[model samples]
Target: MKIKNLIPGLLVLFSPLALAHPGHGGDHGFESGILHPLTGVDHLSVMISVGILAALFGGRSRWQMPLSFIALMIVGGILGVSGLVIPGVELYIALSVVVMGLLLWRSVQISHQWVTVLVMAFAVFHGMAHGAEMPFNSHALAYFSGFVLSTFLLHLSGIAIGSAVLRFSASGRLVKALGAVVAMLGGSFLLS
Candidate 1:
């Protein structure tokens, strides 16, 4: 759409990356897990982009998409913790952001079932990444719970923002613009 519409989304997507914290180490707990997604731009962008995608899709997708993501993410996490290697986890994760953003930018209409599956697929990478990073001696259950909770909150935040943009702004250009920004970020990740 219009360049102005993309500006807001770009800002939201990029601002957090600039402020992302370097990965932390040492004692792990619920708190550490919660902070993990917030610390990395990749995690943060993907999580939020999922929420936005859900919101844009509307209907059952609003809840189903996010739920599917969390469920499959847990499974992915299990795979990671079990030492199952999935090649190109980083590449897939980055692709998720790009695809989600493109979908949002284009406002592509896909069925809820397909959307759920799409989200679930991307979530595996996210969950796996988190699982692989678990501290060797940390409480696995607690850490998993922490990241899940944090991820849910981020999705909710994205939904709220997306909903507001769609409802308040005329033409909903803002959301589309944000999607472009998210996609750009993904492209940057792929290149780096």
Candidate 2:
């Protein structure tokens, strides 16, 4: 493969580290939930994969899934801020990357309603992680806006990449490969 074709793969491999936010797990006067996704590798992968799956599926599924995730995430965040305990939040997040990647790889299509339920469930874990990490005294509006916007953009970026891949002849196989990679990474996360 040429350097151009390799760029996306490189980007994917390096994304978690590249997007690492400062003051992560530190006192930033920011809500933990808002910053949670930014600091965690699993969260980053799931968010990006959500966007990619949206683009690959296209139509209403594209917008609907991510929107469901974002909306539900806020509710989760609220729960997190309230100190509500959620078990295995991190593990579920890692699993989300694996699940979404596989779904995209197979080019699987599910009913819109089911998709809504699934995305909402995952978003709660994501939101809770973020909410739990935020500082209680932080500027609430900016903290919330930053995380929500960042998550949306990550999803959008994935959508864009998937769209671009669709234009290629080998895109289907490429997607499956991406799924495998995500699964591997997720498994590693789970074990660690």
lDDT of 2 by residue, 13-121 (tens): 6565543444666355334434556676677778877877777667997898889899998888788777894887767777776676666666655655665677789
Query: Candidate 1: which stretches are off by over 4 Å?
Result: 1-22
Prediction RMSDs, each to the true structure: 5.0, 5.1
Query: On a 0 to 100 scale, what is the lDDT of residue 91 in model 1?
Result: 87
lDDT of 1 at 20: 44
Model 1 shows how many backbone clashes? 2
Model 1 residue pairs with clashes: 6-177, 9-178
Q: lDDT of all the models against the reference?
A: 0.81, 0.73
Error at 120, model 1, angstroms: 0.6
Which ten residues in a row are the worst by lDDT in model 2?
26-35
Q: Over all chains combined, what TM-score does candidate 2 have? A: 0.79
User: Per-residue lDDT tens digits of candidate 1, residues 27-70?
Assistant: 58677778877777888887887888788788888898888899
Per-residue lDDT of 153 in model 1:
99
